[model samples]
Target: MATPSAIGIVVSDMKKALAFYRLLGLEIPEPAEGEDHVGITLPGGMQLMWDTEELIKSFDPDWTRPIGTRVGLGFECTSPAEVNALHAQAIAAGYESHKDPWDAFWDQRYAQLRDPDGTVVDLFAATP
Candidate 1:
């Protein structure tokens, strides 16, 4: 069976994107001059890659950034405190918190924030 692997994200600027993910406590590999990309190891060993426009355009010529609209990427955490901590980290890293971390009606602690490219990331912790 084929195992699930990395998710790639296209970013307008590599430097800004790198810094943002670094603030999330990911170990970013040193970028190579011609690479225009960086990878981060998520909590569960899943990898996430950030690609520059030039690199992404090579894959999909029509690819473009979504502006003025929310496209969220949800990340599940082990606990509510973990969710709140990540939300705090994002806010401290100079990003605006779209929603303060709070217990959801559906029994989860959740919060949202926007990345440099306008991508919203949802941090969620399941509550029993």
Candidate 2:
């Protein structure tokens, strides 16, 4: 069996994408700005990588942007309040919110936001 090592994202705007992830507490290095590719390692040793669209086309000339949401990443917050706070912070920073924070029937406080590349990012915490 193969182990998954990293999650890769193809982004149209590197700066904007990096900024959004940075706000989420990812420690992407500042020097990654303007680069064609960038990445950061998560706490569990899994890597999250971002590559510019042009970089993808450089090798795969037939590459095309996917329609709608092709990927979704879920982030677990320490508490329900943190979920709401981060959701509001993301929105206030000009990012798009897909769904406001709410208590889900599944017993989690959840919210959704769109990354710069239109990826669905979910924030959640166990409801008390």
Candidate 3:
């Protein structure tokens, strides 16, 4: 079976991007805050990476930051209320909400938000 590895995100400002992810509970090293690239291994051994726009261009000169949410990240909260709380926390910290928490037909509490780079991040909990 082919296993998923890392997710790479190219950002214009490495500092802000690292800060945003750190706010979400990911541990980002202080020194990496100013680096051109940074990454961390998640629980399942999946790596989440961030690279400066300039770093990406070194390989793909025509690369551009894609607009809109073509790909997204999903977070599972411990409870339905936690989903709402975390969503609100993210918003309070200045991230934009894409959708407010709602009981979805799929029997889950769901919400969406745009990260610093405009990537959609989903928060959910099993509601039923």
Q: Which candidate ranks first by TM-score, i.e. highest?
A: 2
Model 1: which ten-residue window has the lowest total lDDT? 1-10
lDDT of 2 by residue, 1-128 (tens): 12334566888888988899999888888754468978788998876888788986774477578775434466778889988999999999999987789887669887878899777677878898
lDDT by residue (tens digit), candidate 1, 16-80:
77778789877887687667767777888776877787874664466566665422366777788
Report the poorest 10 consecutive residues by lDDT, candidate 3.
Answer: 1-10
- Please state the error at residue 18 of candidate 2 in Å: 0.3
Off by over 4 Å in 2: 70-128
Angstrom error at residue 47, model 2: 0.5
- TM-score-superior candidate, 1 or 2: 2
User: How many clashes show up in model 3?
Assistant: 0
For each candidate, the alpha-carbon lDDT, in order, equals 0.71, 0.78, 0.74
| Model 3: pairs clashing at backbone N, Cα or C within 3 Å | none
Error of 2 at 70 (Å): 5.0
Model 3 TM-score relative to the real fold: 0.50
* RMSD vs true structure, all candidates: 12.6, 13.5, 13.1
- Residue 54 of candidate 3: its Cα lDDT? 89
